[model samples]
Target chain A: MINLLFLPLVIPLATAVACLLAWKNQGLQRIISLIGSFLLLIAAAVLLVTVQQDGVLSVQGGGWAAPFGITLVADLFSALMVCVAAGMGLVVAIYSLADTEAEYERLGYHPLMQVLMLGVCGSFLTGDIFNLYVWFETMLIASFVLLAMGGKRAQMEGAIKYVVLNLIASALFLAAVGILYGVAGTLNMADLARMLRESESSGPIPVIAILFFIAFGIKAAVFPLFFWLPASYHTAPMAVTTIFSALLTKVGVYALIRIFTLVFFAELAAWQPYVLAIAGLTMVIGVLGAVAQDEMRRLLSFHIVSQIGYLIMGLGLLTPLALGGAIYFMVHVIAAKSALFLATGMVLRLTGTTELKKLGGLYRHQPLLAGLFLVAALALAGIPPLSGFWAKLALIWSGLESGNHYLVVAVALLVSLLTLFSMTKIWAAAFWKGAVVNGATDTPLPLSRRVYWQMAVPTALLTATTVLIGLWPEPLYALCMDAARQLLVPDAYIFAVLGVQP
Target chain B: MSSIILSTTIRLLLPLLLLFSVFLLLRGHNEPGGGFVGGLVAAAAISLYALAEGVAAAHRILIVNPRQLIASGLLVALSSGVIPLMTGRPFQSGLWLPYSLPVLGHVGTPLLFDLGVYLLVAGMALLIVLSLMEEE
Candidate 1:
């Protein structure tokens, strides 16, 4: 069980080395990544089942006990995240297979992708804050490669900002870890939580908490800190943008959820309300940015920021129901967001453009594509019987239960309306127009089997997961409850780290 | 003639600069030196050579692109803390070697992590320098 925890991380990292060493062999690289991702998918499933049975699993390194050595632990939350990351990675692999990876051996996109996935999975499951920082830096390096692979004018320009901003964020994350390490004298989350629980009035506690909050805030694309995302995401290749849209910032949100629940729980009374305010404003501002965008990808980028506010809203509320909603919605958003980006990728491939002005009547011409896109879009807008809707209801119900009804209701209403407005623009400009497509007006080439298969499989799988989970959320709900419990207990994690059963 | 002298100076000084960078990285964790400082020193060495040679020529001599190096170095560094997962411990629980081979009885993942940091900083710092030099 313990070794399995490392598979999702190790396989990808190992595969990356192979890919680099075999850089000349594109087919080999593709096969290795596909197989490697599939193996991780299997590992994630195994982890899910184990967590369901045992609740939280911990592994100690070099035979050293907790607080003295590095530890990797998985609760239901981490396991669930591992599944999401591996599943999405598999889909992304299939998406990349249609293109040739051989022509650019020097850039090593294939290898970088593997390493990036390793970092994401590691961050999701790690119990140590310093370890998380290491993973964050790991992920950032791979991102630099993936972003700059094209080396075109736009890519180079965007990579400059992307690398610089991420570097600063990494530095801040390191600083937070240093501060936490210095104060806590231990990097283990469970121990820190226990310490924090014991020492409520400690002066540096809130300071360290605030530092972590802002560091993760930058990663999560909170309202004021989100300027870097929209500027750079639109510049990358559609495929790269799609994967980034799905995974990158969500990792930030994931960290926020992890740390707030674990190390900073005491700050809830004083600081959480402020978080709620930021959450509300982030939703409003993010959607407004989306509404103002004309480019399809840019529009979607802004929506990512907006949807993140919804996840943060749940955290701000700090109730089980709200957190559950947040978890469910994160899954929904991951599915819907990635699907929307891929659908856009298909549209771009078909039409060679992403500007909405140059795109119209896609629904009539490509009904299948339009259908998939609409499903994802509507799900994103929180329509009922969809994943987004269930997540919202849970959050709203939880918020209402806590006497924060007005805040929850108002924010939900405003954010959903704005979400609908932005989505409707997509519906109108891209799908609803009366058959006047600009790029291929006279003779549109039929969609290729490879392209259709490349996108359709992942889209169908995600859509089904969203719907199924929304309709019958018992399993995921139970999983999240268990995860939240593990996060709150702090003792289970601590005992696991220290090699003691107390 | 002046150009020849400049190129000769670059040729003579690059090795010394690189060696000094190693010294900084080796002494980093304990004695006021570390990865970031060492990385900058290495970048200075590379930039000096890049100035004498054309950007394209320097790129060939450097071999790997800085972006890829940054990515791989990061991966290396990240794996340092993460290897504990396989051993059933926390992500970065110090897997120490207790190396007492002829006086060096102190070693752990953090040192390896520092090495990763050194490589990443070197690659990242050089990437910027290379980009600017290319533009020039």
Candidate 2:
């Protein structure tokens, strides 16, 4: 029962180590790594069940006590993170098996992949404030490795900017922690929240929040701070970029939600409006960027920046419905975005180019793969009967209900249409035209299996999940409500930390 | 770039430093140290070796394989809490025992929890530093 929370952490970590130790045999490492991801998917499912029956689960360290030692908590929010993370990880791993086998052997690819999973899941589950910082660094480090994994000329060029930006973010995070510790005197989140309730930070809170936001903004790749993402994302291997595009930046967004809700709630009125503005700009700018791009992955990468605005917009709305909408959309986005990237990998594999000009008409040649791409793309565009529609519906409803009518209603409608526009560009550019069969060939295109065999299953599985949730969203909706409830009403969490009933 | 002099120093120090890091993690529950510090210490052990051994060798012997230790530690830490959750106590409520065997007898979830954190910090830090160095 209580074992579920730790499984997300354990399964991936062990698999990575085993892969590293036995990495000499690529076959053995791949099998073990796949098995590990499969096991984590199981673990994430069991965790959802546990959270269904139980509200929130906490683990005290070294068997000592809370408030003193670090803890890893699995509230509904955290559990959702585990499920999304593990689910995406499994999908990406499967997608990359064929996509990345050569790199897996000749370098440190397998180990880095495992470690990245560790960082991602850990960020989702940890209960401590400082622990969050550790997890962020954890993911950042893995991303650095992954970004520079291939050691190509462009990767090095892009990796430098990625490194400098994240390094500053990391330093700011450390300095913020020092202040948080200085002001609150505790690094544990629940304890700090409880402490913060008695008083709001005067001198340092805003500064710290900004610092934290900047750090996360850089990671999340928000409007102004997002330059690093497009610059570097296109340089990595298609598999690596796809995972980073789908998962990494969102980690920053996740932390933003965590801190703003728990520790920084006092400043919500002031910050929400600012966050709302950023969300709107992010969405608008992101779509515009996508519209201008000629490359499939780069355009999609820009879209990721914009869509995050949607998530942050929900946060700015700050109502339960809005917040739940954000969470739901997060799941939807993870599935849709990762699937889109994986589809790109398949396209890259077959066509030997991600350039919209060099390739076209993939739909006629690879029907199953094209179909998978359409479903994921439509989902990203918030079309009906897919998970994206429902998530958008919730955000819009929450917006109207809360009476932030203009930002929520008007911008929401505009973004949905724009999302459609950006997605259609990919549909038009990558799959619509007749197959070109270009002469700029290099390593030669792989003809191995049905694009769906290794690739389509993962993307289709996510798309199906999107559709299923769109069709009958009661269970997930209920779970998200419970998760949000646990977050908003902090008594249980506070009690978890202090054991005091006041 | 792959200097032998640095590698020899790392090789000479890896065992001793990691042993010290484990010491820091185990005793962190009651003292000034815990997962973060212990993790940093352990990560330091690995990163130091990475500088000395070349990124490839260091990745092989240390962090590349051992990041999973955190999860096992987390499981051990988390299971300590279930002892109470099953008995209708709140999540992570302490079941302390003031033992006859000096300080270590104070074994509880806090200690187990710290151990989990220690491993995670160590593994994660190593993950970042190693990956970055490899790129370099």
Best-fitting candidate, scored by TM-score: 1
Model 2 ranges off by over 4 Å? A437-446, A450-452, B1-136
lDDT of 1 by residue, B91-110 (tens): 55667785544433466777
- How well does each candidate superpose onto the true structure, as a TM-score? 0.82, 0.82
Query: Model 1, A305-350: lDDT tens per residue?
Result: 9888888888888777788778878888999988888888777777
Candidate 2 residue-wise lDDT at A41: 88
Q: What is the lDDT of residue A356 in candidate 2?
A: 86
Best by lDDT: 1
lDDT string, candidate 2, A113-140, tens digits: 8778888988888878788888888888
- In CAPRI terms, where does candidate 2 land? incorrect
Worst 10 residues of 2 chain A by lDDT: A435-444
For candidate 2, write residues B1-136 as lDDT tens digits.
Answer: 6677777777678888888887787777667777788789878887887776667777678634454554455555556655666665545667766664574666766676677677667766876787688676
For residue A2, model 2's alpha carbon misses the true position, in angstroms, by: 3.4
Predicted structure 2, TM vs. truth: 0.82
